[model samples]
Target: MKMDLKSKLLHAVLGAFFAAASPVFAQETPNVVFILADNVGFGDMGPYGGGELRGMPTPITDQLAREGLTLTQFLVEPSCTPSRAALMTGQYSIRNGLSLFIIPGTPNTLPKTAFTMGQLFKDAGYSTAIYGKWHLGIDAQSLPSAHGFDTFYGIPPNTSWDSAATVPGVMLSHSAGDVPEKDLIDKGPWIMEQKAGGELKKVKPFTLEERAKIDVDLTQKSVAFIKEQAAAKKPFFLYLPFSMGHSPNLPSKDFAGKSRIGEYGDKIMEGDHHVGQVFDALKEAGVDDNTIVVFASDNGPTGLEFSNWSALGAPDMGSSGPFRGRLGAGTEGSIRTFAFIRWPGHVKPNTDSYAMFSIMDFLPTFAAILGKELPKDRPIDGVDQTKVLTGESEAGARETLLSFIGADLVAARWKQWRIYFKDEVRTGSGHLQLGGADTGFIDRAYPSVYNIEMDPHEDVNVGGNFIWAMEPALKAVMEYEATLKDHPNPKPANVTNFGGN
Candidate 1:
């Protein structure tokens, strides 16, 4: 084993060359932690506008913004299930029969054929898991575990934060003689868990009291997952959808009276605390530098008139920043929200991108990063935005995004111009209200166009003066329609069966 200096130097050079060329010697893939906030608004967090003003000081979120890239014109669908469907499938929710929020026992369910973000990561040699809401469906075939997530925890299928509000009192008034309280409780929602290739199992009853503390449990479980993956030295993808921003915004015991505003503010502050905890966990596990942390909202805020649960205190729902309309309407406020990405070394810090980014873009963008090929059989609306994220280009890949409510395309955004094909009006009292419901749409003789950058509130319609804008806007619509010839969307869920077929 005694080698001369010349022989030793030659061996070292050969070893270095092999290490540089071999796939086995490549660097580890980056891990992704995506935290999805439910109905959190553009002006709700500190960096956007409303931190101290709204009595919710989000120091953690502000720090994250400073440490990474902030997306100013980030857009999403108007409601939960549709937005979530877009996020998961990299396409318009209408393509998957989930363009509206899915109600229990309804015909709308996630189609089995639709490919998901989880499956993409799973195929890329990353350990994937989703904790929190799984509103896609309650069916065994449609659960997160079935769709390529290695683990699933939190709310049961098709249920949301309000599922915990059915208590034995004034609101949930059942016929005492006909329906027993015990029987109702047994049939109520519970915190569920499942692993890949396993059946979903209930962990505990998700009562109103449990709802206040569910986000805490979710944070704990997510932290554990992070630590476990770090120890194994495995690349992982964690999707944590927090329940804080949704109405009945009850905070945990520690953050109960922390905010000067009402229950919603308290919950917002609690969300900040949870964000800090996850960041700390990543740092402690020594995976902070290699992990990509993303924070974003599912949609705009819920209105005071809809699902106003003042159980613990006043539900100061949310503010839509400078925009006017709330969750449902096809207005700027309804679709525009906040998004932050902190990819330590890859993304420049304290930078802002005004480029229009869609929630659906995550899937294709992630696919590009992981070197995965997308399925060629289906049409993917999302474009690869790796260049934008890495600062290679200022203008993003997408220029036009079509906004749909259920099966109908209500609006379309092209560059800074928003063209509305239908006028939206909020329904009066005595009308049945849902998240993206209670808003009647009337067909317009000519599409109304608003330069969103100039008219942030959409106050002035320049459709008459800038009638030429209709050509490009309508062209975007026409191009999407042309795709229907080859790849028609699954039949509308309401008219068809539950599977969206």
Candidate 2:
């Protein structure tokens, strides 16, 4: 009953073609729960090799991996905002003018024109809600409610964790009477919420203490949403973007000091517990076998190399597994992280795929699976990855992904080759700043190349011998440029620079 590689590829291609041509059959639609962990490295979880080895036990997530397919080559944008934009829009973040992280009060925001996954599910008759971390924008047009979610809750609208540290960090940095301390601390960024077609409202000040315990509230809301949807027998889409492992890694009081590794370890352990709670809710609702669960990190961790660990009183920060560099840098570890997909009977359990899957591919893949059509008005970077996810194709539907850091195409991955356009070295501080680092880019005489399959660490450059590989990588770049000629991107949002087109 087993088909050979050629036959499988042919069948997959034909099946995709026929499915697209035929009218959507009245098949069972599975509920979707996508859990996006921020700043989690590949080696941080039990399944990918962290867990107890790193003094953090993640038995719950480990079991999730065992019951589904784990991706070894899942790729994402270099940082949080870009990765999340790509996930929601099915386009490169640059296309949406969101290539950089949106700083508080900056002009940057998710454009009102972009189509999102929340809208996609809502149009398909699924109840949709997003809990925890909507870093897209603070304005009404950019919030989750505008994009199609029925409800959204978590951190302040349009700000990062730095907003939580504002009470002392901002209040103390400035002279007294420059701004009232009470107003600065008390009226600072608060936990915010919004319902569809409703105004975004503040709930409570997002203090350092609240930040430590925010994940618990997010998890509780998600469980309630799932239960509510199940009671109504409606297909639902739940996007749980956890605020764990980002920075100032604070675990709840219950999990504090429970891990051997420090605050960072405790946070991951806490995240594991919350993931288990969501899974249990699905089972208790009797939707366990009829739902698709995707657990993935937006990007890699912030290793001690980028931050001052000694000052934070933590022996370690985060692990990039076997790769080099951390979250902000242009390296394999920065973009390549963990992703697991579980759909009970649909996805084969305990399998691993080395397919080149990008975060942008989710929208189109979900559309295809749900028998919905993607908008034809704009260029969608994501390809249909249904065949890959359904075990019909071992080789995924995509081979190339371009990585950008504020309009600059820093790197490109084609097949097993990772090609770098510039040489970037970390400059001691500014790792959490706008551009990801206080580094300078050196103009390389020739592009650096690494065969990722052979050299996972990117220790050696084989570009001289494989100069021909750069042809395909550059071709991908040229093709993207060609698209910009007719359908140009909006000027990218940059506070420091004014030279984007």
Top candidate when judged by TM-score against the true structure: 1
| Clashes found in each candidate (C-alpha, N, C closer than 3 A) | 0, 0
- Give one digit per residue, the lDDT tens place, for model 2 in 18-91: 88866333335889999999889988988889999999999988898899999988898888888999999999
Worst 10 residues of 2 by lDDT: 431-440
Candidate 1 per-residue lDDT over residues 121-181, each given as its tens digit: 8988889989899788887767898788999998977878887866555235654556766
Question: Residue 189, candidate 2: how far off, in angstroms?
Answer: 0.4
What's the TM-score of each model vs. the native? 0.93, 0.91
